[model samples]
Target chain A: MRKTFNNELSKMHVRFAEMGMMVHEAIFRAVKAFVDHDKALAHNVIVRDQAINECENELEKMTLEVIALYQPVTADLRDVITILKASSDIERIGDHAVSMCNATIRMKGSQRIAEIEVEIAKMGDYTCSMVEHVLDAYVNRNLERAYQIAKDDRFLDAELRKIRQRCMTVMQAAPASVFSGSYYISVATYLERIGDYVTNVCEWIVFLQLGEIVELNPSSKNNL
Target chain B: MKVKRIRIIRTFFSDAIIIFIFLTVIFLLVIRQVRNGSVSAWGVETFLLLSVTAIILAAVDIFGRYLRFRKRKQNLEALNSRLSNIIEGTKGKHVLLEPSDPYYELSQSINAVQSMKDMISKSFVTQQRGYFSLIEYLTIGVMVLDQDRKIYLSNHAMSDLIGREMNLKKQLYVNVLRTYELSQLIERVYQDRQDQHAEIKLDFSDKVVDAHVVYVPVSEHHFLVMALLYDITELKEIERMQMDFVGNVSHELKTPITAITGFSETLLQGALKDPKALKEFLNIIHQESLKLTELVEDILSLARIDASPELKLDEIDIRKFIINLLRPFRPEISKKDIHVEIQIPNGCTVQVDQNKLRHVINNLVQNAIKYNNYKGNVWLKGTIKKDSWFISVNDNGYGIPKDEKERIFERFYRVDTSRSRQNGGTGLGLSVVKEYVEAMSGKITVDSQVGVGSTFTVIFPLELPTAPLNESTK
Candidate 1:
């Protein structure tokens, strides 16, 4: 019976990893679509969001089943609970990827905001890396790495502030670009939100280890 | 020492009291005899006798009691020292006593208890040895950590995985496991008192380890965390290759299907009404469909070869086989004004499956003709070796680039897709040639230089095996 329980736990881990890769791909393509102004790629990213949600549901169900049948306590219980919560964070990141795509679709064939696009792209890269590292930390149970990722979210936060400033300056300098400028801001905001969710994942990693829910990014506390 | 002295004095005092009581009884008896006039006389001689006897008897009684007290005192001292030695964790012998000794029964009981302890401890040591040996020989890496995240135990596999011998006892887990991911996993198990799991790529080595961390509750208040590492680098590589294959296949199929659908849609929309343009559009559709057909057929043939690699052997005249294989490509060769040369010994025979060998020759010859420049030369040469027949196809065409030679046989791999498409070449032609050549107990290799020429040499076994060999062995 213990062996069967362990097998189920391993299966849950594999599912979570698969979900991580899927979300990573989605965010990557979503950012590329925005930068390249590819409507079809954006549409594909939007369509793929349902798969992420479905994967999240499947992971949650498996976690619940393991808890109910095994009635595991201590570390076993902590593992299941961590996966259950982390999957939701990952699913939210996937949603933000779709939002990124939606923002891309809104500003179809407009004058490219070169400076802001560059900033958003940087922010996108940071957010994707955060998602990847945090998931790895979760899977590996690397507490120190989880802590490092939590700290890295501060960098993304700073980048978000810089992007906001640039978007405002561009809009103020030229009124005609305000139409596309607002969409760029929305994209940046979505990326920042995605970074926040990644921070939440890093927090989950801390919780999984220490059984403590810590607010790792202090600056984001008021917003939360 | 004081207590023993007091005990001896107390024993002497009790003995003196018993003697005194005896003397009083004797005096009373004498007095009664004298008063009843039963004795002749109460004389000085009789009194002297009674007094001397009583004195002697008291002396002997006191002396015997002193000897017994001394013996018991010595026995008690020896037993006390031995018990103290045992309590202090020293190996001490049990005090030996004769059956007649005063403390013999106590000495026997102490010895019994000591031996029982020895037996229990020896069994425990043996069991511990067995447990450690079992873990040491296991193939999977195992590490145990205490609640403080200190390394308690590790096996041989753990050392191999870490790429070093580790003295892990009482050492913090992070100090031993260099990977941050693994250290954190151990910490998670320790803090949460639950089983955790992770896959870690090692920084010190190029190995991917799948770690399963589990919480072990030794008692109500004591627990340990165990991490098991399984190397999964090979599995990961296989998974990546499978994914790449799927991606490449889909991409390859999508292009032709898109072209066919798009061109046909253009024709149906209005181009068909324009008679002059209709023929050209129809021809493009037809060519794309043919390419698609060739691609599917190549894929199916590869699948068949993979599923069953057994070949049906037939003896073929080399000169005749070369002529028959090049017959279909003769028109193309002549159209391109390419010179064809066949240098095969007459009456020389090779054993192979006729149909599969035909496919191999057909692909090589077709590639030679299609890639040849105008008025270029194509050579088909056969030679006999000790155990094999070497067939070489030489083409003086725009030769393959140096870097692309190795990947030319990969499915759907084209160095220049537009050029190949314009020349009506399906990208699967070389890959199919490679697969068929190998399926017939042969090996294929290419020698090419850009702007010079290419020679594709296929070496077939002189005699194909009569019985099927295991596919994997080949």
Candidate 2:
């Protein structure tokens, strides 16, 4: 029975890793579609969101089954619970990826302000790294890495704020592109939300290790 | 030395006391006899003689016993030295004792025990050698950790995985592995006393390894953690490639299907009432259908190539083959004002599948003409080697970038996606060409420079082999 429980746990780990990879790909392609202004690629990203949802549902079901069957304790219990929470965050990140793609689709053929695009791309990269690093930390049980990801989320928050400010100025200057301008803001907002979701994953990792629900980035909570 | 002297003194002192008591008793008896007047016939000489004889007999007996004691001590000392030598594994001769010596049988027993020990130790050494050799030659990485989490054994495969030889004896597993996932796996195995598995990516090496760590119980209180590492990077890459292939196929198929559907739906939504609009839309529908047909054909060819590419080989005249192949492209060549050069020696023949070879040549020529700048040159050259024929398609056009040269032949890999779409060329052309070329027992290579030119060459054997080559030959 213990063997079955452990095997199930390992399967859950693999599924979580796969989900993390899928979310990573979604974010990457969504950002690429936004930067390249390729609607087809954006559509592809949107379609892939369904796969991510399915993965998350499967992972959630597996986690619940393990919990109900084994009633794990201490570290094992902490790990399963963390996976449950983190998989939700990952699924949310996937949703934000779709939202970013949706924003890209709304932008259509309009030219984005070059500077804001760069800023948003930078934010996208930062959020992606946060997600990737947090996933790695969860897998390796590296508390330091999780803490680092949480710290990096602050920089992403600042970038998102700057992008939002820049988008407002651009909208005021070019009233004709207000529609695309709003999408630019929306993309930035989605990326920021993704960063927050990654930070939430880091928090879960912290809880898994310390059994304490300490927020690593307390100030970002208000923004979220 | 002091203890031995004390032992000797103690032994002799007891004997001396007993002899003294006897002497005293004899003297008292003599005194009694003299007092009773019973010694009237006894002389002093007789008395002295008796006393000397008794003392000599006592001395002889003591000396004889002492000799025996000394001999026994010497034999025991020899036996002890031999035993120590055997324990130390030194080559030493056994002590030979006289048969009359009391320690003879003891000496024989000591020799027998030593020989048995020697035999057992020799066999143990051989077994150890065999065990180490077996481990050294094993392909799977193996490491054993004792109950203290110290490394007790590691194989060559383990060292290779680590990228260096490690002094693993008594070394902590974490200090050796340095990978947190694997270390955690080992720790879990140790704690749970069960087999555990993890997929670990190493920081120092570009490898993904599947590690199986098992707990081996040596005794009631002693156990070992054995870890086996199997590199799964290639398997992972293949898996990713399969996933990418499926995704690309879906995306590629979706584009034309969407286009065909949209245009037909527009026509059906009353665009057919406008004659000019209807014509344009029908043309687009026709073009998308053609593209769809090409895509399906390319997919089928790729699938065929994947599933047993059986070639029907035939000898073909190179000059005639080129003429026939270029006949269809002649009008396009002239329209684009591109210079066409065909340099094939007359009577130059090679063995290949005629239909597959035609397909290969056609794809390369089409790509050459389609991608070439206006009035650029396309050269088709055939040369003969000792055992093979070389056919090359060289184009002076918007050449491929240097890095993309390697992947240009990959299925659906395009240098510029929009450009390929504009040129109306399915991206699978080069991949199909590669497959057909390889199917005919040939090799293909490409060289390209950005904005300069690109040359693709295929080499085919002069005569097709009657039998298949060994699979390992590839």
Candidate 3:
């Protein structure tokens, strides 16, 4: 009986990894579209978000069935629970990436503050790093990496703040340039939120490895 | 693991007592019915009754022992398979033990061992996985160094970053990294057990990488260090190229702008009174403006090449193309008193981008004419291979130095800067030729001997990809 349960758990693991890859691609393509003014890529990211959602639903169903049928305990139980939590975090990251792509589509062909755009790309890089590291932590079950991922999120947060401050200063100098400047702020905000969702994932990894719930980034201000 | 207490002696005592009482009652009843029978006369019947009771009790005890032993045998088999499965990292069959099985406690212990094995094997697999398989796909190179400052594990990405495949296990960290500062950084991280990130240039290829050294505590006292090396060589190259390009363009533009302004100012400051001086000054200004215009146009087209470049392909006879390309160069060819030889077959034809091929021919032929000595020999050859075609332009000109051969195709790089500037060369022809050639999926190479001669070859693939490559911005 436990043999069947373990099979189900491993299947959940594979599907969760697929969701990880999809979210990673979405985040990557979304940032690329925003920076390169690639509307087609932006639309692709938006459309692929549906697949991510479906993957999450599939994973949740599988996890729930395993828990309901087998009633796993100890590490086995923690494995499924971690998958449930991490999948939700990954799904939310996909959502944020889609919204970022939306802003990218809207900001297409507009005059951008060049300096701020460069900073936005840097912010996007940090967001990608955090996402990748958190997923790595999950896969390797590395508690240290989870904490590091949460700590490194501070870089993304600082990048967003830097973009915000610079955008304001530039807009004050040339008020008409506030159009793309606003888009930059919104895009960076989405990246920041995505980074936070990655932190939430890191927290789930901590729960998996240590079997405890500890918020690594409290200032992320997660409501639920 | 539950086992019920079974007392053979106690159960046998109870059975014998009941049988004895029943048989004794039967014997008493018989005696009461008999006319003159005594208890001694029924000795054989009593003995037979006792023998049957003993036989029945012995039969019951043997059957129970046989059933319990069979169960124990089955349970032991299940436990064997279960234990083997757990040891092999697979889900094992349940060792369902009957309460009376002798090794029920043994099966229970296997269950405990299985769970512990699960945790242990899971960690081991993940650790080895991160060391080899998982990190193999990562673009960032990862290496783990043990407490003895020796290589514990590394992935293919690390070998790729190091520019060679090597036996990385058990090697010293300093030997593998080949950067003293990086070794020092690892030492500092080990001392403080803090994460440190630095930009270090590898000694092998001089690639700049972000060396993120993390102090990974393996256990309580013993710790290892993990270095995540993210190669930013391409990024640094792009940044350096952008900076160099900006600086070069500004300098290239400023040279002529300064001359135009300087001579015009002189012309206004009384040099305009002398008729010859006025005419020469105006001519200098005109020439400088023309050079400036040429430079600007070259820079603009280079930018276009950096964009999505298109190759207008056509089938052209190689001989005819060359003859047509050399038409405008005839004056320079004759002025240099050079003998031009075209050793190409009459039927050599290729599917090529016409204008791009023209640019390639123009640049090489123009350079040959400009650099050749008086009566120097210049030869051109075209050959069609099975899968590729190449055109070689050979000239007995002042050849390039071996050190500068690679940089000749770089933008704004000129061999004889003074001579080319005086000849009104924009120093962009070879680089432009390179761009045009690459747009048509071709390569350019040069073989030169400083005083002997130089051969510039342009080779193109016979077949073209029907679909355009993915567009990447420069």
TM-score of each: 0.40, 0.49, 0.51
* Model 3: per-residue Cα lDDT over B1-474, one tens digit each: 333346555666666667667766776777767845566556777678766876586558756876776676677778888877876778865576666667878888998898788888899989987757777778888888887667887877878776544336886554334344465577688668899999976634547898899988779989889888899988987786677667777778998899999999998898989999999989999998998999988878788887867777799999999998889888887887899999999998889888778878988988888887777889999989999999999987666755458768878777766667667677788888988878777788998644446799999888977767334222
Per-residue lDDT of model 1, residues B32-81, tens digit only = 87677455555787657666666667668867877776778888988888
- iRMS per model, in Å, is 14.2, 10.7, 17.9
Choose 1 or 2, whichever is better by TM-score. 2
Count clashes in each candidate, considering only residues at least 3 apart in sequence or on different chains: 7, 0, 0
Error of 3 at A36 (Å): 39
Residue A120 accuracy (lDDT) in model 1: 76
Q: Against the true structure, whose TM-score is highest?
A: 3
Local distance difference test values of all predictions, in order: 0.78, 0.79, 0.79
Candidate 1 to native Cα RMSD, angstroms: 15.8
The residue ranges of model 3 lying beyond 4 angstroms of the native Cα positions read A1-224, B1-92, B97-132, B171-198, B203-206, B303-343, B346-355, B368-379, B394-410, B413-424, B446-455, B461-474
Write the residue-wise lDDT of candidate 3 on A152-208 in tens digits.
887887888888999999989988778888988888888988988888898888898
Q: Return whichever of 1 and 2 wins on lDDT.
A: 2
User: DockQ of all candidates, in order?
Assistant: 0.02, 0.02, 0.01
lDDT of 2 by residue, B1-474 (tens): 013767555655666656656775786688677788465545776557656655665666667777778778888988999999988988688789998888899999999988898899999999999999898778778888888777898988888776545446886555445344576677678667889988876533546888999888889998888899998877986786677678768878888889889999998999999999999988988987888898999989888876766677788898899999899998999999999999888998777789988999898899899998788899999988898899899997766754357667777777877677678766789988887777777888997654456788999877766676434123
Runs in model 1 lying further than 4 Å from the true structure: A1-224, B1-134, B137-140, B147-149, B160-172, B184-199, B207-225, B228-246, B270-283, B311-468, B471-474
